[model samples]
Target: MEETSITAEPGKQEIVISRVFDAPPDLVFKACTDPELISRWWAPESITTTVEKMDTRPGGMWRVTQRDAEGNEYAFHGVYHEVTPERIVDTFEYEAMPGHVLLETETIEDLGGGRTKMTDHLIFQSVEDRDGMLQSGMEEEMTGPMERLAELLQSLKQAAPAR
Candidate 1:
């Protein structure tokens, strides 16, 4: 399994998270845009994720909720500015933080030979907000979901029926 890499430069309000997956670009793209597929691997193993709304198109909106073992809920909602097979741009805001919105752009690269690389570029409103996100166990939360995503991708690939 490829490990996730998260980079956040000091004094900057940007973060870049990336990982390689052992699947094709189309499959990766589908896994990302499909709400059902998203809920399957969008959260940590200890949490349950529900896709409250998802409309993969420009000017569309999306909402997701995650519940932990203790039943604590975390809700996130966003608006899609752009959506395509290879790229997606959206605004992400956690309901708990109200107005701390961040712009996120995810790109899916076809690395050839049944491999794909997914990269997320996130820009926060300010350095403080970016630092707060980094300090809030964001890396673990991101990594856990990524690992789950890899597993899901592998299963989907295997289930493709010799095509």
Candidate 2:
């Protein structure tokens, strides 16, 4: 079993989540980059996600549609600024609210011993926007999705021995 930690700095408009998974860095990175795997745990629990497009390369564009329990939908689109096997940088925006944009970079560090540390750094255009998201329950929404990701990795680890 691996440990997970999440941290946030309200003043800095930063949220950092760290989790140790019992999988190699490459595999862990793929779990994030692959649309199929992403959709499996992208939204909070009981919500659903659909990837309309996902071209994970420099200058490529990606879009995902998420629906909540009440059937309310939101779409997110992004352009990849940088894409490597273990790191990705992109500009993200919600289609419903186009003006609210965020620059996000995610890095995966190989910790050796079948462990990886994934960090997501999201930079908003203004502190107000960041604070608004926090007040909108972004942290709570993130909890279930992250937990599902950990469970997914655990299942992968268990299945590996049978393969």
Predictions: Cα RMSD each: 0.7, 1.9
TM-score per candidate, in order?
A: 0.98, 0.90
How well is each residue in 1-163 modelled by candidate 2, as lDDT tens digits?
Answer: 5555657676776666667666777777777889998999888877799989999989999999998899999999999999997789998898887899999888888989877787778888887888888888887777777788878777777767643
Candidates' C-alpha lDDT: 0.96, 0.82
lDDT of 1 by residue, 36-97 (tens): 99999998899999999999999999999999999999999999999998999999999999
- Which residue window of length 10 is worst by lDDT in model 2? 1-10
Task: State residue 87's C-alpha deviation in candidate 2, in Å.
Answer: 1.0
lDDT of 1 at 3: 98
Model 2 Cα RMSD, 1 decimal = 1.9
Local distance difference test, candidate 2:
0.82
Regions more than 4 Å wrong, model 1: none
Candidate achieving the largest lDDT:
1
